[model samples]
Target: MSIGKKLANKTETVRGAAKKYLGRATGNTRLRTEGRLEQAKGNTKQAGAKAKDIFKR
Candidate 1:
């Protein structure tokens, strides 16, 4: 994966974790669900980047 994409994915994952924690603390189901979705999005992006790298090779 490109460095920029890697960094962005990591940031997303971290932000998701933070949001999930905040949601849990505040008893907000919607925020917690959003956090889970964000984390999944980050993972999907990372997977796509890896696939691109493999195909480039």
Candidate 2:
């Protein structure tokens, strides 16, 4: 994956984790679910980018 994309994914993952933690602490199911979804989306994108790079080689 490109450096920019990798960095972006990592940042998103971190943000998601923080959001999830805050949601749990505050007992907000919606925020918790959204955070989990964001993290999953970031992970999926990162995986796709890595696969593309591997195929390009």
Candidate 3:
């Protein structure tokens, strides 16, 4: 995968984790769920990037 894509994917995952932690600390279920969703999205994007890289090989 490209460095840019990897960096973006990692940023999303890290942001999501931070949000999840914040939500948990604040007792906000919605925020926590959103954070989980964001993390999933990041994971999906990373997977797609990897697949694209493989195909380009």
Candidate 4:
């Protein structure tokens, strides 16, 4: 993937991790679930990008 897309995905993953930890510390199940979903979404996107790059070779 492009640099911008890679950065965006990484940011999302980092933000999600922060939110997840914050939610755990504050006992917020909703926030925790949202964080987990966000992380998964970011990871999936990154994986898809990698697959595309591999196929382009």
Candidate 5:
């Protein structure tokens, strides 16, 4: 993956993790779920990028 894309994905994952922990600490179930979904989205995008890179080779 390109540098920008990799950085964006990593940022998303980190942001989601922060949100998840914050929500848990604050007792916000909705926020926690949103964070989990966001993390999953970031992971899925990263996986797709890796697949594309592999195919390009």
Candidate 6:
């Protein structure tokens, strides 16, 4: 897990949040679900990367 992956995960999380809100405001269920999934994926990636870093130490 390199810094790039971590950064990407963080960025994805933020983007996902924005998308979620946008979806909510528009009442678009599909967008909302997509955003939620993206958020989860980002969180998972970040956690995995952190775990890898910890093990590396």
Candidate 6, residue 6: how far the Cα is off, in Å: 1.1
lDDT of 6 by residue, 1-57 (tens): 777878999999988888898899999988988899899889998998888889999
lDDT of 3 by residue, 1-57 (tens): 779889999899889888888899999999998899898889899889989989999
Worst lDDT run of 10 residues, candidate 6, spans 1-10
Question: How much lDDT does each candidate structure score?
Answer: 0.88, 0.87, 0.90, 0.90, 0.89, 0.89
How does model 3 score by TM-score?
0.85
Number of the top-ranking candidate, with TM-score as the measure? 4
Residues forming the 10-long window of minimal summed lDDT in candidate 1 = 13-22
Q: Count the backbone clashes (under 3 Å) in each candidate.
A: 0, 0, 0, 0, 0, 0
TM-score of each: 0.83, 0.86, 0.85, 0.94, 0.92, 0.91
Q: How many clashes show up in model 3?
A: 0
lDDT score of residue 45 within candidate 3: 93
What order do you get sorting by TM-score, best first?
A: 4, 5, 6, 2, 3, 1
Report clash pairs, candidate 3: none
List residue ranges in candidate 2 displaced over 4 A: none
lDDT of 3 at 5: 80
lDDT of model 5, residue 4: 100
The digit string of per-residue lDDT tens for model 2 on 1-57 reads: 669889999888878888888899999999998899888888888888889989999
Candidate 1 residue lDDT tens string, 1-57? 669879999899888888888899999999998888898888888888888989998
> Model 4 — which ten-residue stretch has the worst lDDT?
13-22
RMSD of each: 1.3, 1.1, 1.2, 0.7, 0.8, 0.9
Q: Who is ahead in TM-score, 1 or 5? A: 5
